[model samples]
Target: MARRALLSEAWWQQATIIPDNEREIAKHYTLDRSDLELIMRQNKAANRLGLACVLATLRYPGRPLADGEVLPAGVLRFLARQIGAPWESLQYYPLRDFWRDGKQMISA
Candidate 1:
């Protein structure tokens, strides 16, 4: 099983601004505009996770993601499965720390 990774408050803060950074994040991920629109239309959870993936990728471009700097692969996989997306499409970090000491939904 893949280990669980935690997202830092700083990363969460950055993710919260996804609406304002949509274009940039999408561009960085090479996401097609139509596909982005489709994801947005899926549901709130899917939209959030999709945006989170894009933001995470933009935050950590290369390999060896920094501590608490990337979303857990398990979390990404779960979200992708929930939204009917392929898990292999996203590049997220593996488990490391717990988000908010396990209070966060993503950590559960």
Candidate 2:
């Protein structure tokens, strides 16, 4: 899915609520300090959500979720409700950028 299609006016509205401090959450999750800082820099909701998706996928010990792949309907609905985004829009929101950027910082 294209990045442009992923973002909508509703997506911005849903992301209005700034997430809790990433630093604290990172500590709780045992994420590396450097990686936590990188995540902190992504102030937008889409980017943050992408980061969350990456982290959530990492918790499972298997092939990670890939960009452009449709998430399970239930999981997508749950995330949409939690973040106040339109559920259908999530299908286009790929995690590639978030994962790549996150990996670069964490690996550096």
Best by lDDT: 1
What TM-score would candidate 1 get against the native?
Answer: 0.27
The number of the candidate with the highest TM-score is: 2
lDDT of each: 0.49, 0.48
Question: Where does model 2 exceed 4 Å of error?
Answer: 1-41, 83-108
Candidate 1 Cα outliers beyond 4 Å, as residue runs: 1-38, 42-49, 52-68, 92-108
Ten-residue segment with the worst summed lDDT in candidate 2?
16-25
User: TM-scores of the models, in the given order?
Assistant: 0.27, 0.36
Candidate 2, residues 1-108: lDDT per residue as tens digits?
A: 655566788975454322244453333334355645655575455654555456544652223555455445555444445444566644434543444534642321
lDDT of 2 at 78: 45
